[model samples]
Target chain A: MAAGEGHRLHRLGLVVNMVGGLRNLIFPLIAIAFGTSTLDFGYLLLVGIAILFIGFTLFFSWLAWTRFRYIIGVEEIRIESGILNRNARSIPFERIQDVSIEQKLIPRLLGLGEVKFETGGGEGDEGTLAYVSTEEGERLRELVRDRKEGAVATPAPEIANNDDGTADIRRFEPEAEPLFAMDTQRIFTFGLFEFSLVIFAVLFGVAQQFEFILPFNLYDIGAWIGIVEDSGIDIDAISWGARIFGAMAALASLIAIGIATGLLRTFLREYGFRLDRTPKGFRRRRGLTTLTDVVMPAHRVQAAIVQTGFFRRRWGWHALKFVSLAQDSKEEGSHVVAPFAQRPEIDPIMKEAAITPETLDIGFRRLDWRWWFDQWALLLPFALLPIVGLLIFTDVGARAALILLLPVIAALFVWLSWRHCKKALDENQLYFREGWWSPKLTIAPQVKIQSIEISQGPIARLRGLAEMEFGIAGGALSIGGIPVGEANAIRQRLLDEIVKVDFADVNRG
Target chain B: MTDCAGFTPTAPLAIEEMDVNYKGFGAINCLVSAIQQRHISNMDEATETEELTRLHPDHVKVTRIVASLFMLVLIIPAIIAETAAYLNQESGPPNGVFIIPVLLIAAFFVLFMPWRRYIHRGFHMSADRIRIVRGYLFRSDTIVPFGRIQHIDVDQGPIQRRYDLATLTVHTAGNHNSTVSLPGLLHEDAIAMREEIRAHIKRDAI
Candidate 1:
């Protein structure tokens, strides 16, 4: 493996670019289709353009190939790129948080891996080696890891020119033990339960693409919705109230399709999900289509969040994500620790992250009941205003009955949310629990908190209520509609804990 | 100094005594205070690397004008429609009359925003962290530790460029509220702040 000098990405990187450029080629093909029949010899032009497109892809790929080279310096890793606009960046070894080695289909087929170096500093990956042989990727990761570890241990590193250099290789191999495994069957079930909001968008895009590509006009799902509305299911049938039956059916179908596709996606991405604990960090290997292996070091992870949908929570199923600098599988900035987890599974995982809320019987302070009223007031605009407007402006009939049901459901949602919300302080960690249907519990260490605050609105002030909010690494969390005294106490506690300054001394001024 | 080992307040200041002195509180004040609650307590003061710096007061004019221009741009269609409707009497009463007051209210916000920000928006950089306090009604004070800050950017809009002022945005890890923006600083100050912060981060690797 090339070590000292700057090295360019593998020649296969050009092929990777060509494969990526296929999407760009589609526009020309689309234009050709649109211009054809009207223009003479359009097919000939299209053929010529296809060749040109591939040539264009190759030319640009070559430019990118030549321009992009990374120099693994003794102290820092330097990446230089751009043809017309020359750009270069040097990320020091200490700054680099983690190195993730990923292999997509093409890369895997070619025995290559994409290495991304992350520096908790958020400007995205500090540096990325687009395509390298799997061995080279591992070697590079090991070399970087050594430098990073060595830098912390001693002021300077001598391992690069060690007597045998066997120490470097030996330490790379951590005693990894299998901690969690989500087999295909479990993943399938997990996927079915993992209903995402993205499905609506996916369906919309797919429907449009299908409409354009298909020779025959496909059934208009929108028309089906209209048909249901026109069916005139008895509005007077109060016992069997199905006023918004059509809308409900449409939504149910959408959810059904979402679950099905979600299942396929889950199977495709996490077919052989496995989690292992290594000396370095938590080693995770999953993905069927694009195999990914990422090491979530103990230090990089900011917090652990356990989230579950209303229905999933009932069946003791939850998804766990770690808020970290690494932009995991998606650009979520959240690494899904366990795609499908329950209280038992999550307890252990959270414990590993030092956020074990299981054994600790921390007393939680519930928000004032007036929080429900505030939620209702907030929900009124989306629920009641529309209903009132419809009732006042339009003829009140079957639609009115359905509109009335909206506020009722919204009220119940608000009530449930109000009941479920609680904030607890467990010595070093802050446990924030919210949601009724789709509950989310966030565990943030108090020392990690950057700042603390207490605020109140006119209404809240009048009611002797306030909100206590605290900021950690990833984001901020608030405990709203709490008693003013409680909020102040929480605020003072957080300030004292986070900042070394005496809250009493500071407040005296 | 009290050992703050437990997650409990050691301060003995009467709870009621700590109530916010909401003097001259307006919409902007409430807004800033609300947003501020997510970060630092009202008692927290700015901590700068050198010394705390407030935004240039002239920046208010730049932001106000820019915002008012945008509001005016939105109001143009309504004004045009109203005039067109007025010319054509057969179209009955002007359809865009209601839009005037709405746009005016929006314009009020545009005017109010910059004034409040000019008064309250300030930033500080310490040896280990950079602090920013913003919002007039909803005061928020955020401190980004050197280790946590991902990157810093100095941006200048046309008005800002003309005024020789720039906005500095410091990004931290993990997306949410990642970018803390401090607008209305001398362009040189913005650049110097960026460099200084970058240098500190580099020096203090941890």
Candidate 2:
């Protein structure tokens, strides 16, 4: 790593610490809102700030003081570093479940990569090595994996001749070779689209943040101008030139805000971005200050979720999330490799990760029946809420207020929900694919399932519909809107198959 | 989880099946609670010895008859109140007068239906395994090979004590949905069932 780059990284960390520490100062306000005593809230904030300060100081000092050294031995990669307390991490070869790499525009320009290590345990069990070059990261990963998998070996071959040497032939070990390399074109296409979307999202976020800062309602200005005429504020009495200038001023302000928002987003989202593969796992390191490194392992991942939002679908950009242990849900604890991955890039990555045509993508069954059942079941809440609203309004003018509100909201919800109940299942897995805007497909392996159950309510029974629930180590995801018999049959088959497999790593050998 | 990589166990074709019924019990209970305002004051006794003892010696048929009669007596008034309210809502009094009665009838209908269903939904145990298929809306079939049974517990509620009966529950490693209760089982039968399940577990372990 270059000394200049290291200095920049240290400065970025200090900025992040200072910004994050600001949260502690506001903690007392939250504590008071929650009904804590003022004294207690003050004490809480004091302790919190102290902890934050100490933690940030130690982290920044360590980053500045230490020099990182790494090496690949047979079947393992060892990273040794520390200023005061020397630290060494040794990751074994077989345990190297995933090796992925990424580079952002800045990192691409700087030729740096962030490497992550995913241990597939409970929280706080994983580690990451960040801000190294992409080439070194890939080389280290290859060395460890080849050594572990007992693949072909070739000692280092010198790419350059040294100034004073006869022949500067570098010896490369057998283990130090990359098993996979990404296509540059696909990566570039993906990065370009993702970079744009992130800029848009950040701008939107900033606009919402500045919503309260505006003193007047710019949205109501046109209507207000008409009102001014009605209220006898003689707009015709004012000069025509002044009116034109006022309108132009408003337009300029709006444009200026938009431009500022866009610029702020671009800088924040793209700062210090890089994605890369390490010896232990796939790594995504991003953010200038408060740098984040996400490491994901292959074996520990229980499911893969592919998401495509409305705009992304048109551009063929998508995101992938890995469902793993103790995450509460598939959406949580995910390592986002890219904010946007183009279809060409996505397809190959999926193929390499064993999540493509041969595996997860095969034999998916769309759950049309769930949509129908959900529509019917929705009637319960439809009936219940209206009745409650009527009852409440009858006495306290709640009805008048609710009647003016509830129908439109409820109707909109029902319409949107109807569009979102679609699902797909296959012989080996079930895809509970739903959502109108943010579509998510949850893939569950049959072997990991704990039980399968089918149930019906009185309304569902009348409709001849049943709900099928697939229970796994996590929790149950129920599919509604299938015929009772069909759901039962599917449930039975799943259970039968589940009982047949040995899930606790007993049969993998 | 240890691997015997090349080994695979044969799937069972079929096992001998036994019909067990606490017949119409769960459904009856569900309906009785719904339609009848007459709340059960003796549930503890009903679930214990009184209910269990009915399956033994000579009182099995007698107890069933007595329980049916009790439910009928409790439901008749609720039916009358609701029918009267529905038919004569205008002439005699407002429907509000019959609200309690209507609620009682609804309660009885809800309770007895499910109770009778539960009674009808008993486990069919054989020498090899136990199978349970349940749910009025979402039906599920749970198969527990007796060999896989880790332990068995014979539970007697206050009512079961009065009837001298017991409910048998089987536990296993994959025991997410493993409840096979012989609600009206005689004490001796419950003990025998427990022993049988325990023996299977022991054999499977060996």
Candidate 3:
């Protein structure tokens, strides 16, 4: 691990690259297999083409493996890659926000991991080492941490140094009590609430793509009916009660399948979910197949979000996430510290992040009443169009006019949302509580707020109401339908707090 | 003065001070009429105000030229359609009727709308923050504190360069409304503004 020397990835990366290449060729390989059964002389030509394709894939994978190299320097890490374009990227030690190690199913078995460097500059990982030995990844992470701390002029934490040129991987192990961990029972309870129909969609896609091997046409309803009759179940001769019972049985089976899929997905993703406080940050380790190890520093946590779904809220279950500059995943911008926890369980984690939890005595103020009326007025016309059309164009009688109930139901929802949406600004933090069914509470410190906007549309101006949108670093916090006076007061108050702090001092910790 | 819509523009009216007459309408209709009346009254308030600074006068001319170019895209196809219909003579309408309205609409958009938009947009800089107000139909007032600025950029397009105008954009760490741009400034003024804001921006703000 000499500085300024370029190192190639482990040779096992070639196997991983080849597997990725072959995965992309599956459709064409399947097509060729089907073609070989239909033609005689064409079979030899297809086989030759298939062999050439596999040879080319293997050649390219090997070439790519040979081309990729990374140089861990004293001040920066440089990566050189690309087959023809030849891309060289240099990331300084101070710019990197965090380092994570991820091991997918194959790499985990091979005792290899992918190291990702998050720069907090954009949407994706700034630098990555695709396949390296787990021990090497850990050593590289520690080296980068030491260099970054050195650049910041801060004393490095007490860890066994590698001054004698020996790798000490065990020095980075977690020794304190875990902040949060999910056992099998809690995971199963979480799975019950996460019922999904994704399995059915996957099954349908498989049937569509590979239906040529099936004996019957899958889409033909007549063929399905014929098969049912062949099984000695006459559809027209069945009793009404029996038909109702059969339909219920079908629905029950669908529910059962959905629950099974949810359980399988949850178990695979949250198998050994654990969160621990380490010297570097709050470290999270999870996943049965694709293990991910992420450490989010406490100072970088700009805001905290407590989320709960409709049923989960009823059962007193919540998830806590921290909004940081580094993204947790491609789709989620916040890191989930506790996927499933109760109010008492989440308090300590929030405390660790320096975010105050919502208390019972906090005064939360509601938005203007026009917030409800504005939504109702905007939606009622669209809802009335269909009901009015039914009443005027057709002779379906009064039953058709029952569609008018749609607007009433919509009005009820608008009222509920307006009632639930509230904001509370304490001495140091801003709390926004939104949503009726699946409520989300966002807590942002006043010093972290970047900008404040007070917007008024034509209708809002008439009602003397304004929407206040707060600009946070990695999250959105807005409260609409505030009276203009209050909106201005809040804006001034927040601005006064934002300008007083020196950001350099804030970043040092 | 009343325009084609029989609506008059007046001095800027605050919501509480205005008298909105809604004698016979239902609650929703009353709300709708109140908004319409306020919109019409405030239309002329786009004129100069005491605290805010209007964009350079040449901005109106630049906007007019750009709008006219966009109108060409619409007018060319419209003229072609009219000529083809006249040649066919069997199914199309009379020749001058269609072209007349289309040309009139294009003229209204190209000749008049730019000045209206130019009047409505204004920006003001205070000790610590910049406030921008724009759009007559959908008014938005955004304020960005100088301490929150991550970077400042002064950009000038080809047309803007000819007019000696530039746009100053300040970037913040916020995801929504992260970059606030104030266009239609003299090139030198934009640069000065950028430098001033840059001076206020502290290092490692995020």
Candidate 4:
């Protein structure tokens, strides 16, 4: 009754959210420490303050839960919320792109879900109905979807199930076909091949915080050598014995364990990675603890980026992602279409998105070599100065001088990347290929380009080259070192082609 | 495709001269006086005064004033730091530091930046497209098609209002260059321009 003539979140909303808030408090608690050995009145006072802070937070959450409500009218959903300063917004069903029902671990355990309305406006995810019963969430989503169907002109079949209807519907979403999915075995395989570096980072952070926790002081190499000398234990390579061998064996197992932990994390994150064809588009349901259901509508996808890491390339495996409007992606403006896919397996997925071989047939054009070597020459001082300084100042100069090879390797890699970095433009699609170690091939439709910027610095002016940047609705993809003439020509041609788009293409992807 | 060494185009930014002859990089004849002359389209050579409209000339004066204010702000920090150091001799840097003069001399060149920007800055509003050009050392020419414009805003600052000037910003559907700002237009002209474009968009939508 206090929440007006609209539905409130599930009864356990306050309890669930309070638990989540308490979990977040763990991070801050580490920063605010009390010396247990010196416990007194001050400690009691600090404890009391902490309790007050937590109590205040819970009180606010309770107020927010009770006040927040949304009513489903005929054409619009009116959401009213706020504990202190009230906020109200009415979103028409037609404007609601998709009602994304998310079931993270906590919500799933409580039989609750959060339904996010990704409205077409650039302002974040337009609205969210948090902590609804999972069954009620399904019902609410169905209601909104039916309303949307009735709101928009139904028989516009040519733009078949396009999420945004921003561009030409080259390919329609196939009828709810169970497309590609990862099995538990292959999920583990993908996890095995993938490496999560977060574990080492977390361990290193902990080691830094609690020096006593570390087996040895990592920074004190001189002290270590002194100990080794005093102990009459020679672990030196030149005069090695069984002790050196033991150290090597320990180091090897440590590396193995590190890799094993990384594999475990990858498994947990992508435990049930599955991609299925939904009525609107593709719904990807993945994760072990916090299950995420990301729906990528056909038209909303701006561009396709296929990336293959050095190790993965050897195995003919690549990861592909699509740039979209919503903030559903872990990576900004992009959602992973396939985490680990073979080249052959990716071909069909690309086809489903309407990025075909013919569209990519435009011969790749390499950037001018001056853009490569000129930057290298300017960057050489910054790269070499530290090594030169070390040689001049530090006793470890002779050892650090070996780092000179790193720049050489980096320059060699840059040369290879220069060879690989190329752009191709056709009537409808634009493709760019970059990277030597991990090649990324990005292909975006011409209609998706928001604007074209042809710019040149004084150096570029002298060379008759420019930086050509193509802006999409979500993320921008740019190919530098384009000849100024070619860039302008491409711009004009793109503009002319853009004018010829049919009425439906007026929207933004 | 195999060897890139021999690959070269005749003209860099002037590709396909037939289509973009009247309208592009080469259209600017002089670095300094070029702002006075409007680019004439080669296609409509018979009608010598081409289609593209130039921005109001008062724009230069306004921009120059803004640049001077910006330069003052930039120089103030260096001046204050040097003054403070000179006042506190014991804790100060090694004496006889004429850093203020040295910084001013180097920073003086920045005063010319606004002039160059003014010379390059231009906007043309036609039936189908609105083009805004800005920058001097690094130039960016943005062409926003009428069909793509999501919204149009006409805004005026106190300084601009005193001079009866307003800036028109056209926001397009594309996220990139979603809003292109064209400053230094007569206030009435800006409103009229927005209404004209708005009417055309509505007409085309149906």
Candidate 5:
């Protein structure tokens, strides 16, 4: 298996990973050397264990380099390797779920890439293949993908034609070049907002930490503020002056940080972002350093989430991620059609991916406003505390605390509901729109739903609300908390749809 | 009480014995009540029966309730009391030890008999599909077609080992809750049912 540029790149990765592990272990060892306690020593020991494991891995990897042999067969892909413990794995063409090709900076430089095969593992385990040359990975991906499609072709096309006569069947075809590529201009535009926020936060945090460095010292400002005529100087004015200067300095620093961070993240994430419509589904590739290629099976996509923020919405910029059968360790895993795309950019991908609002039966039974009202019940009492306390004390400190607490409480209440008060469903696919600061939209296929539950609490009952739980098969795809009426309607609808449909005829029905 | 035995499928099939309705305990009623408490309201009050049917189809729910009640009334109290006593730190008259044992034995007549009489039922498969209608408190009727069967698996466990019994798991594709595990069947009976379902699938395929 270790033959060509891909082999050299894999070896380099092994070396880099080993060094990284060692560096992390050295930090704790250094701390222990500086008179840290037994707990610290224990931590260091754990780190050493990891380092040792990695070391042993390097040794075994070398052994495998000699023993390994993989045959990308016509109907099956087989990997045979191991020194002391020999093992061989062979997966037939029909069972292959997805085949992907990826290339990172090193792989790009070396003209090599990695290929991964996803199989129908239940929940925890998926399939993977780590390293291959770019050309080899592409070749393997094409062969496996084509074989799987060819196996299922006769039935799928016939079913598709029966279901929707006008079905625009798109076959899986590998592209020589990427479907979408991020230009320098687009990257810069994407960076602006991120860069600004990062810069602002860093500046504000630094200013808060070393606030004493300001020209107007708190004590000096207080002395200047002679509030009681004979008591003290006008410190309030002095403090205000200092605060203004600090704010200006912070703002300037924020701008610089924002730009740099924004550029870096944008450049790295969408360096060569691509989304291609394949026969079975969509294949996505992005990244500069550690490139990732995700080939998603349309049948496995339980949900499609489109997210946009206030700024993003205004600019028509959004991101879409597909919720599929990925394991817990890969919870954030999704087939991203594009990173930071505008509405127009996302349109073609959505259409090609066969994710449309009309075809997908999304339930819109929103959680009643009462859901938000219940939160205020808990919120109002906690918020009233400082105000009640202030009424008794009437002191300056008490007054300020009371004054500050109101807006803070109000903000908390707003943010809490703003983020959590979600709209979700159990459709032919489950679709949801959630999140406050960084809002997201998600859609999932129904067959992937692990379980369905209907629940109602006393408070919710009084308000005529109920919650439905739809457990997606893979990790983190499961979403809950649709309204009572909506939950039931969705449940009923899903039962009507999912229960009666012949799974073998899923493509048709 | 409703039992699966009483269930008469609309189609033609063998009926070795039918248990259509559960007799006394209102197991479905209790479950429905419990389920009702967790949600704000039933999605459709008019179709509470339908919802129950969807939640757990009639035949399967009845068999489960009947079998579970037997365990609940006869076995659970003993297990619970013994477990509580074993787990309890103190020896006392009203605490885990004393209360639990009394509760276990008392449960046999007090809770067991009544519940056993109230709940417990089974279903019979007819031509076309299976019909299961059994519930004590909240009545439910479920009908499933044989053609809808995506896959089927037979399972045997240690407990079933003692009784020389097994369970049949039926799955329908696209339905998360497609599995209907039919238990409390004799080993031979289960094999026959498996063959029946297999034949049904084969017949429907064309």
Candidate 6:
């Protein structure tokens, strides 16, 4: 736990790396198991090859572990890695936006965690110290935070040593009231709303990948029918009512599987979800198996997005997210501060981020009426082409006319979206409300806008309307169908406000 | 159709004298009308003065050369395909039948389109910001404040160098529309613009 010295990762990381390498060979191992029956020369050769592969994996893991080292200097953290091709990356303390500690299932059992330093450069974590002791990770995070703030790198008082060398680190004491926390019942309800069919896709993939190991062909419907018939069911002579009931039962089970998958995934990801406001930043800790502790400073928040589905909105549930330069995960561009909350509950968290929620009395401007008409005009022809082709070329001529219903539905959707899409510019913030079914509200501060653009296509020019786009670091703020004059006025106003403030006072990303 | 000369007896007059008298008047009238029309259009242009500076005149030639090069890439393949089809067929249109239309279209694109593009592309500079206006059918006007510029780049290609032209690009922190490039500026102007923006960026650096 000394600064200005090189340190290696926990020794147990070699075991984790070896296990990870072996997991990649699982399919081939399974193939070998099924291919060989007798202990002949072929079996011996296969076994030898497998042993060699495992040996190589272990040797490489050990080599990598020995080669990797990190040094915490006064102004920067330098990481040296690679076996043959050496790479040394030094990240200045001021450039590091935040530090997060994550513990996967294996590492957690080994009392190790991965510390990631996010620089908000959009590429990814600038540096990561994998498989460090939990206490070491916490100490490193505190040291980086202190150095980033231009404070002396003093040891954090919270991480005290015990007489016996066992970690009794009090990670959470709940000194102040948490901004948001989800109980089991709330998570379950959220899981219900998140009903997913991804489990079916995963199961299908597994079945496809290992179909040869199955007793019968997985995709052959005749084989399944034979099995059913062999079990004393007369499929050919079954009544229509019984067939309908069987189909209903199958549908019900499919729904049940989907719901169960959603619940399982939600429980694994959102168990013990808590968000607390620390003096330094907002601390978010969650996950049942892979625990992640992230602290994002409030000033780095570029915008706030309040999202809800049609059903969730009806039931009064919304999710709050902060659009920061540091991403929460690979796929999520924003950090989810409140996974499930009501309006009143979300207001406090939004206030902490200095983003105001849409008020009832605030006037919102609707887009031009032509927005819907233009879309319908462009889409209706493509829709009619297929229907007309079916009507002319097929025997079901009159019935094909029923296909016109699709275009009707599309037109309705465009109309509804045009109705729902609205934008409001207040004295301090720009609010955009979009999506008809799943409404999302994005609130961005006026001064955070980096640039402005007003664009016009041929049609937009004819209509004397323009699309206005605002440039922010992390989030998107754009609205179309404003009159040309209004767009210019808005751009001038925003530019005036942007130039008035000295950027030295502002936080860049 | 009957000959019109037989029907002109009702309005016979001194055509040569009228033509001689009206020629001078018509020239003066056209000159006056052109000046009046130009004045009206100038008044209209003054109100919407978004594009303060146009791209260099030589950019039209550069664009034409580039477009012709691109057209040749496509034209060569098209000529080969048409020749192959003509030779493989027992009886069909002539060898140049398909290629003629392609050549005509390519000629239109290579000869005329660059001028349209040159007329549409322009940029305006203020003390605090730069506005770029581009595209003919799909016009876009982008304004980047100097205070927000993260960096500035002045780039020139071989052809651009021959024409003494360069492109100036300014990068901002935003993801969308982060880098706005204004091509076809005089090389000296582009470098001057980059230096000016760089100074502003340094002044505003945190």
Best by lDDT: 3
* Candidate 4 Cα errors over 4 Å, as ranges: A1-177, A212-218, A222-244, A327-331, A357-361, A384-407, A502-509, B1-53, B68-111, B173-175
Q: Write model 5 residue lDDT over A390-471, tens digit each, in one string.
A: 7667766644664656756666756565455455443455566666666676665554444454544556555555455554
lDDT of 4 by residue, A381-465 (tens): 9989988998888899578979899789878977998999988887678888999778999988887666677666666655666
Off by over 4 Å in 5: A1-121, A124-178, A195-247, A278-281, A297-300, A326-333, A357-365, A375-431, A443-452, A458-464, A471-486, A499-501, A504-509, B1-156, B163-206
Best candidate, DockQ: 3
What is the CAPRI rating of model 5's predicted complex?
A: incorrect
Q: If ranked by lDDT, best first, what sequence of candidates would result?
A: 3, 6, 4, 1, 5, 2
Give the TM-score (0 to 1) of chain B in model 6: 0.68
What would the per-residue lDDT of candidate 2 be over residues A56-118, giving only the tens digit for each residue?
765765574355555454434545555533333444443444555555555555666556654
TM-score of chain B of 2: 0.48
DockQ of each: 0.15, 0.05, 0.18, 0.16, 0.07, 0.15
Evaluation by DockQ, superior candidate among 5 and 6: 6
lDDT of 6: 0.74
Q: Between candidates 1 and 3, which one is better according to lDDT?
A: 3
Q: Once model 5 is optimally superposed onto the true structure by TM-score, how far is the C-alpha of residue A18 displaced, in angstroms?
A: 31
Error of 3 at A299 (Å): 1.8
Of the pair 2 and 5, which is ahead by DockQ?
5
Instruction: Say which prediction, candidate 4 or candidate 6, comes out ahead on DockQ.
Output: 4
DockQ computed for model 6 against the true two-chain complex using alpha carbons: 0.15
RMSD of each predicted structure: 11.7, 18.9, 11.4, 11.9, 13.7, 14.4
lDDT of 4 at B206: 38
Q: For residues A197-260, what per-residue lDDT tens digits would candidate 3 score against the true structure?
A: 9988999999989999987999899899999999998989999999999999999999998998
Candidate lDDT values, in order: 0.66, 0.50, 0.75, 0.67, 0.53, 0.74
Candidate 6 chain A: worst-modelled 10 consecutive residues by lDDT: A500-509
Q: Can you tell me which runs of candidate 6 are displaced by over 4 Å?
A: A1-174, A212-220, A327-331, A502-504, B1-51, B77-95
* Candidate that beats the other on DockQ, 2 or 3, i.e. the better one: 3
Best by TM-score: 3
Give lDDT tens digits, candidate 5, residues B105-163: 66555545433322323454765455443333222334445555544445555545455
